[model samples]
Target: MSTSTRAGSAAPSIALNFDSIAAARAIVPRLAAISERSEQLRRLDDEAASLLRGSGLARVITPRAFAGLEMSPSAHIRACAEVAHGCAAASWVLMVCVAHDYVIGRFPEACQKEVYEGDADNLIAGALAPQGTLERTPEGWRLNGRWQFGSGCDHSPWLLMGARVANPEAGGYLTYHVVVRQSDMEIDDTWRTLGMRGTGSKDLVARNVLVPDHRAVPTYPTFIGQSPHATAPTYRLPVFAGLPCMLSGSVLGMAEAGLEAFIGHTKSRRDVTGASKSANANMQQRVAESSAEIAAARRLLESACDRFDVAWRR
Candidate 1:
C-alpha cells in the first residue's frame, strides 16, 4: 500500500486547461498510425501512449479540484468515440483509465488525496469482477487472488480490484474493493484475442497484500451515487450505470470504422461476372444497408448518452 508523501497536505484544487473531446481528437492521427503496431505488440504503442497522456484526455472524469476537466458523461462518451475512430484499442484504454478516475472520486477524501496529490495524471487500471478473497484484519483487509481482464494496465500506477470480503455479522461474503499500487501486484501476459487485441487485458495477481482501511470502498454506495462530494452533479449521478455507456462509444466507433473500410473496398471490388462493385446493383444495396445500420446505431447510442447528460445536469 502506498501512502501520501506530503505529510498533512491537502488535495490540490487547481483547474485543468484542456478540452477533453478536443484533446482526444488531436491524438486521433497518432493512434491511427499505430493501431496495427498496438495489435502486434499486444498493447498500446509507446508513442501513441505518450501522445494520449500529453493530450490530457485520460483525466476527463478526474475531479476538477485535482487539476482535471471532470467533463460530463456525454462529453466523455464523445471523446472516447472520437479516439475509437482512430483505434479501438487506444479508445478502450482511454475509457478504462478515465472510468477508474471516476471510481477513485467515489472514495473518501483521504484516498483521493493519496492518489491525486502526487500525480494528477496517474492512470488507474481496474478489473471489475470480484476475483479476490478478502479477510478482515486490524490494519485493514488481506487480499489474495488473481484479477483477469486488467485492461490498460500497461501504463497505470494504481490498480482497482474487486474482492469478496467476509461479513462476520451476517455470516455471508460480500463484494468489496481496494485500491493498490501497481508494484504490489504481478502482471501475467495472458491476453490474446482476435479483435481488440491491443487492449492488453492481462491478468493481475496479488498474494496476501494488505490494503489500508482508508483505501477500501463499499460497492453498493458507489453504484447508487454515494460519494464524499455528493452535492456535485457528476458525483450524484448513478455512476455505475454509465459503464456500459462508456463502452458503447467504442463499439459504435469500431462498427463505423469497419463499415467505412468495407465501403471503400467495395468501390474497387469486381464481381465474378467482371462488373465493378460500384457499378453492381447488389453491392450498392449492401453498402447502403450497412451504412444505414451504422448511422442508426450511432443515433441510438448518442441519444442515450444525451439522456445521461440531461440526468447528470438535473
Candidate 2:
C-alpha cells in the first residue's frame, strides 16, 4: 500500500494480512504457561520476554521497510487477542511495545532511521501520560520527572516518555514524546496489583537528562495527522483508532478463557438440587446462551475491525 502524502490525511491503502498467524499460534501454549508464572512473579520474566522477542511477536507492527512485519491492523489485533487469551499481561506488554513502533514511525525519517537502524526488534517500553518536564538547553532539552506504569520496562533498551512542554503564550501544556536511552531512567519496581500483575509495570524516573531536539515528538500536532512524519502514509493513520482495539482484544481473549473454564466446570458440576449441571435443561440453556453471546460479541468486534481495515486499505 502506498503511503499518503497529504497533511492530516490518513492513507487508506494498508490491507490486513495474516501470514504470521500460524507463527503466533505456535507460541500461544508457551505464552499461557509463562503468563501464570508472570502473575506469580508480578512481572514478565526476562526469559518469557525473550521468548516473545524470539517468536517475532514484537515485530508484528513494525514497518516492512524496517525488517518488521508491517502487518495489517486487523491481523495485529487478532494476534494480540490470541496472546491475551493465554496471558493478558504478556499480551498487554506486547501490544504496547508493538504499538510504540507505529507511533515512532510517525516521527521524522531521521528519528525513524535512528530507532530502527540496526535491530528492528528493539523493544520500547513507556507510557503516554504527560508526567515529565522538558526545559530548553543549549544542546537540546533537559528532561526531569517521573513516569509511572512503564510496562515491560525490564527488557526495553529505549524508553519513550511523555512530558509537557511549557507553552508561555498559551499558558498551557503541550505534550511531547521524548526518546531516552534506558540508562537515562531509573526503574522503580512498584507494580503491585490484584490483576494484570505479570505486567511488572513500574515507575521510571528521569533526572536532568539531556535529550536532543530530534528525539522529541509533539503529540498535539500528531492528533490531526500533522506530524513530522506525516508525509509517510503509515504516519497518517489515526493514533487513537487502533489503540483501544488492541486493549479490547486482550479483554476479549480473557473472556474467551473464562468461557472455556465455565464450559469445563459445567460438565462436572452439580447444582444445589443435586442434578448434574450439564444435564439440567436450564443449565444447558444458560451455557448455550453464554456461548452464543460470546460468539456474537467476538463477531461484532471482528466485524468492526474488518470495517476499519477495509477503510484503512482503501
Candidate 3:
C-alpha cells in the first residue's frame, strides 16, 4: 500500500523532479502494447526505450549533483515492477541503468561528471563478475578479455564491468567497478535464453581499450559506498545494500507478472480434460498459495529497502 522513491534529471538544472515511479506506472499501457515487439527484437523497442528514458525513471538513483532524483529503494521496486508488469525486458534495462548512477556516485566526481555531464540521456549497462583483465597504463588502464552478462549494453553508450589487475606489488585482486566506453567494446550477441530475452544481456569483449585514470577507481571504496558526495544519503549506502535492492525490482516485477498472469488465466480456464479449472478446488488452492508467496516476496523486499533507508538516514 506504500512506497516513496523519486529522482528526475533535467540536465543543466539541479532541480529534482520527483514522481518517476508515478511516471513509470502511467506508461504501463503503452509499454505493454510494445512488449511483444521488444521481445521479438531481442532488445528494447525504440518506443519502449524512449518511454523509459523520457519518463525520468532512469535517473532515479543519479546524484542530485548530476540533476538526478536518487530515488528510494521502495519506489525503485514499485517502478521497476510496474514496468515489468508490462514488459520485463524494459524493466530490467531501467533497473540496471539507473542503479549504475548510484554506483557512479561512489566513483570519483570526475568519473561522475564525465558520465552525467557528457550525456543528458545517458544509460549504462554493467557486469560485475570480474571476468576481464585490466593493465596499468600511463594515462589510465587498458582493458582486455571478455565479460559476460553485459545487460542493456546494446542500448547503452557505456559499460561498467569487472576486471582483474595483476599487481605484483600488492598481490592479485579483482575490480568490479571499471567503466569503459561502448565505443571500445564489442557486443558478442550471445544472449540466447528461454526468458527475459529482451534484456540483450550479451557478452562484452574489449581489446586494449583505454579506461582513463579518472574513469576507474579502486572497487573497494565504491563497493563499500565511499563517495565524494558526502552529503547524499543514497550514495552513502553500500552497493550491496542499495544496488541489489533496486535491481531486484526487475526480478520481483517479473515474478509479480507471472503471478498475475497465472491468476488471470486460471480464472477462466479448462484443463486438457476439458474440465473447468475455474471451478476446481485444487486450482483455487494453488492460486491462493502462489499469491501468498508472491505477496510475501514483495513485502520482504520492501521491508529490506525501508530498513536500509532508515539506517542510512542517520
> Which stretches of candidate 1 lie above 4 Å from their native place?
1-18, 168-173, 229-231
lDDT of every predicted structure (CA atoms): 0.76, 0.73, 0.74
> How does residue 232 of candidate 1 score in lDDT?
46
Per-residue CA lDDT of candidate 1, range 232-267, in tens? 456666767787888888778788888877878877
Query: What is the lDDT, from 0 to 100, of the residue 187 in candidate 2?
Result: 92
Model 3, C-alpha of 31: deviation from truth (Å) = 1.1
**Model 2 lowest lDDT segment of ten:** 1-10
Please count the clashing residue pairs in each candidate, in the order shown.
0, 1, 1
lDDT of 2 at 46: 72
lDDT at position 27, candidate 1: 86
Q: How far does residue 312 in candidate 3 sit from its true spot (Å)?
A: 4.1
Which candidate number has the best lDDT?
Answer: 1
**lDDT tens digits, residues 219-242, model 3?**
776677674533466666777776
Q: What is the lDDT of residue 288 in candidate 1?
A: 86
